[model samples]
Target: MACQDSDTARLIDVELDESVGRGTPDVEHERAVAIFDLVEENSFRPVGDSGEGPYKLKLSLVEARLVFAISRENGEAVVTHILSLTPFRRIVKDYFLICESYYDAIRSATPSQIEAIDMGRRGLHNEGSQTLMDRLKDKIDVDFDTARRLFTLVCVLHWRG
Candidate 1:
């Protein structure tokens, strides 16, 4: 017998809105990485539901807000949460700026300088993830790593119209 981890919620399927434009290479790459990481390991448990999952999630932006439509593998709805984008505006802006700096640093700056910028980027990323966890509280239960991956996906959606 082998012990398997059951604490993390695995995403069996994920879909992003079709209306979102195909962004730059960097943006697309970020989306890919985030989705891959999210599907690989996550902690998602919808409140007030008896369903156990490996969940399916549809992520999109509607009327300037972010939405998560979660369901079981059987296609039954678990819960839907719409989160305001207002609180994330400043943090997203800062993340983008730091990301640009980090990318440029990778191309031209010294290794030490790049490391410094990367540290700042990671710090801002953590802050955004924490904000996400706070907002999702009482709605859905998710761990920090899951929140971080979801935040990346949200940023990808935010990058578009």
Candidate 2:
């Protein structure tokens, strides 16, 4: 039998173009989990004649846009889509601020305070993810969870880029 299984349109691996840089352990952990969760379970399919997937993706910030560079399992380039980061800017900023609050709350604030901040963080995250999905509507297909995870990765990229 062939070593590779049947080709399916999904993400198998992912990479970030730049290091997030110094003193952000929490951000680094978020990046790691985003990649792990995405590879473990995601629905990714590029539109048009991109060929079969089971893809390896590299996400990067180029200028003001976020780039999705997709390749096949064999390392053949499949498609590249650059999405404008404009729509996500405000929400991402809000998410970061809420996350900071949530983290600080965990260390010293009451459980209720932590929960409230967490809820706000989750709301902003979902909004950011949805905006991403809308922006990529014609270029790629991604489920809410995949978009959510990808949004986290994007936030990290934006944080450093």
- For lDDT, the strongest prediction is 1
lDDT per residue as tens, model 2, 1-161: 11122348688999877733433776677678878987988788887744777889988777787788889889999889888888888998888788878878899998888888888888999999888888888788777887888887778765642
TM-score per candidate: 0.87, 0.84
Q: What value does the lDDT take at residue 36 in candidate 2?
A: 93
Residue range with the least summed lDDT across 10 consecutive positions in model 1 = 1-10
> What C-alpha lDDT does candidate 2 achieve relative to the native structure?
0.79
The superposed Cα distance between candidate 1 and the true structure at residue 65, in angstroms, equals: 0.6
Look at candidate 1 and give me any clashing residue pairs. Answer: none
Q: What C-alpha lDDT does candidate 1 achieve relative to the native structure? A: 0.81
Q: Which lDDT tens digits does candidate 1 get at residues 100-148?
A: 8999999999999999999999999999999999998888777788889
